[model samples]
Target: MYGQGMSLRFGVLGLLAEEPLHGYEVKTRFEEMLGGTWKVNIGSVYQVLQRLERDGLVEATGDRGDRGRQAYRATVAGISGLTEWLEDPDSQPQLLREDFYVRLLLLGRQPNGHLARLLDRQRRVYLQRMRDLADQEKIARERGRPQVALLFKGGQLHTEAELKFLDAVVDEMGKE
Candidate 1:
């Protein structure tokens, strides 16, 4: 369901479900909500919004100001669509382009002590990401974006788990 469409569409719907917002508000909120992980251009957001409106999933309200700021609200169809998309089965597994994982796989061919250093560095980086995710989660919760909060929480948990696993690997290597 999510695969057949751009993730930005669902994200925009989710945002609109909260409250009516202008295009500029949507763009700023989207970037803020994703913690800058998803860089959505203004053109793309407007395009998706236009498509959503054309599909009758969203409706635009009157201009709000002298700048011609038109606000968009999620229609009943949009809410249903977003709910269905969230409930859909794994249309596609998330693909992570993890350079560290690739390096770890190739570490056996490297010189002495290199793997240990790399793993140590990975642990540090993962810990930092965990911290960042935690911070994002907190911000999302404070801002009343529970869905965004949940996303960041999941990321934090995954990073914490990876950090723990990396620490174990480093310890085992040290004993070898």
Candidate 2:
């Protein structure tokens, strides 16, 4: 995966591409979208939004409510920037979280049944994630963000590959 900062920036742009929203709304939507797997700090979201606005990638629309909350929308340049990033083929190679690999390594010593169960659980999770990605891609397509759809399609491919790999592992365990 990309660095947290880059991922967070992409996420903010993605949200704004859907609709203009206040800072809090952005954070809330992000959490909701990630299913709480990601926890973004308010300060970090605000800082990125400020930088984006400064770079003219995004613009502050106007204040909302009596408390004067500022709302942000993605500028045309922002959408173009996101599309460029998505199309760039030079993305850093994904770095698997070492902790999960370590756990898998340790678990490899266990009986085949245990490994089979683990792989089964992983396959299910990957399939569900792929379904979610497909749904998101459809939404992006409907919104005229073909770039976002492409990104989501990549994610779907990754999930499908994982599911295939897990299935192989489960089969190997059965043979053992």
Candidate lDDT values, in order:
0.84, 0.80
Residues 1-176 of candidate 2 have per-residue lDDT tens digits of: 23444778878998998899889889999876764447899999999999999999999987585579899999999998888777766455554654545566678897655655666677777888988888988887897878767878888987787777676766776686
lDDT of 1 by residue, 23-79 (tens): 889999999877667788899999999999999999987758568888999999999
User: Where is the poorest 10-residue window by lDDT in model 2?
Assistant: 92-101
Let me know the TM-score candidate 2 reaches against the reference structure: 0.54
The number of the candidate with the highest TM-score is 1
Candidate 2 regions exceeding 4 Å error are: 1-5, 9-40, 47-92, 98-100, 171-176
Kindly state the number of residue pairs that clash in model 2: 0
| Clash count per candidate | 0, 0
